[model samples]
Target: MIDEVMFMRHGRTAFNLQRRLQGQIDIPLDIVGQWQVDMSGFTLAQRFYWAKVSNIARHPDRLSQPSDPPIRRSDITEYEQAPASRRRMVVVSSDLFRAQQTAHAFADPLGLDVTLDSRLRERDFGQWEGMSREEINERYPEGYASWKAHEGGEAAYGVESRPDLGKRGSSTIRSYCDDPQYMDEPTTLFVVSHGSWIAATIGNLMGLPDSQLDNLTGMRNAFWSRMEPQYTSNSVLFHLTEYDKGPDVADAVDWENGPAYLRNPDMPMWKPLI
Candidate 1:
């Protein structure tokens, strides 16, 4: 009974290329983003035997249906159980286009159904939803420090506070992990969501301090971040209670593992400051 959570950052969005704080911005993934995610999916799927798609299907009742199909598999023809890999699961993004599209790449291979949930949506940026950090600083400098500090009392015009992001977004993930529909399966869990939401989710779960939280940025689209949960007598029972962060092989995680486009499987080197 190994509890594993794979937090995948969404693929490259227009906001990502601009070096802006996407913060709940609903931008589509670029071509490179698609490639990145697909690569992650392939690599991770190979490592595991079966994959559970994040695109969980819900009946009108909103309860996740067990009979719900998976979005991807080990084999393209019929998703056979591979001896070398473990079972994998894909959690489709609630963001219609990005999530669905990302799910399609994996689902089409295994013929699994993609599960969708609004709760997994990126952090609602509030007033800052679509604007970049530079724009925020140019327009309102006073609010910037509060934002950097993650002080939620005051807001940057209409953006969501760090506190609110932690409260709602983190709560949603906790509920998801507890919910049988998302967890309860033995396969690996792959979550697809916005950058801010991903950071907030991990930060809140780990109780990351404000300084640590502020240092994070969004996950690169389609890249998988590693996390593991250990069994402890005192910890919550029958579930993945609190996971550990692993080095993000895809270079996409709660924090940037290293500079992008620097990965060379053959060379295998990690250096700061790309």
Candidate 2:
């Protein structure tokens, strides 16, 4: 079984800065976005160190086992894995430019190949693509109102339906989980995609109710959320382990209710500098 899945949102973009609807527009990361990815990569390096350190501190006997992985610092671009460490990871990213860029940030440091998957791309915004909220409200008032009234079920002309997006999210997870390569190892998979896709994927994995689905918040740019398995007799269920990041709006998250120390005690505190 896959040990854990980490979902990370792409870094900031020109459209993100303007609060514009990206929706698979293929925007490149801006300067600040590039910096965010760089720093986030370093943070990930630190995170691995602290994760093992904490585990050792908590369970001393585990250290005596030669099979235990030795935790060591990497130069951020090339990491050497101990024989036991498997320091291995897989990065799956949306085909869009921004998402690919974000995946590269981590893949470069962790020495993992990025698997490009269109299934992980952001929802198709269609007519709303590249438009800001105010622009949508001003130019397509009726369509905007309809979308809001029906939540995501309805959308502007040519837009993909919310139900379809949900289905895609569900299928993406199912397909990846069913892959023999991933299932055979205790691999850590990093899924780099857009905000909407990430939330929808997580919600589907957790089997959250429909009403609560739309309310799930997204992580900040360059930030990540973690999920791990809860094995059951008939099947395995995944649970959110760590969350809570900056650039978030009021009250959108309800799943994890934490930047839980269980998996992410070492992550840097989120600061919305951009």
Q: How many angstroms is residue 182 displaced in model 2 relative to the true structure, after the best TM-score fit? A: 2.1
How far residue 78's Cα lies from its native spot in candidate 2, in Å, is: 16
Residues 112-224 of candidate 1: C-alpha lDDT, one tens digit per residue: 55678777776666666566677877777778767765665236476765556766766765555556653444545556666667666677666777556666564545654
Name the top TM-score candidate: 2
TM for every model, in the order presented, reads 0.64, 0.73
Worst 10 residues of 2 by lDDT: 254-263
CA displacement after TM-score superposition, residue 163 of candidate 1 (Å): 3.4
lDDT of 2 by residue, 1-274 (tens): 5677888888878787678889989899876667666656666755554334333333444354344458553232211233324434667899999988988886665445688999999989998899987888898888888787756634546777655676797788766666787665466777888888888778877887766667787677778888886557766678999763432321343212222322245333323334
Model 2 ranges with Cα > 4 A deviation: 49-83, 150-153, 231-234, 246-274
Best by lDDT: 2
Provide the overall lDDT of each model, using Cα atoms, as 2-decimal numbers. 0.55, 0.69
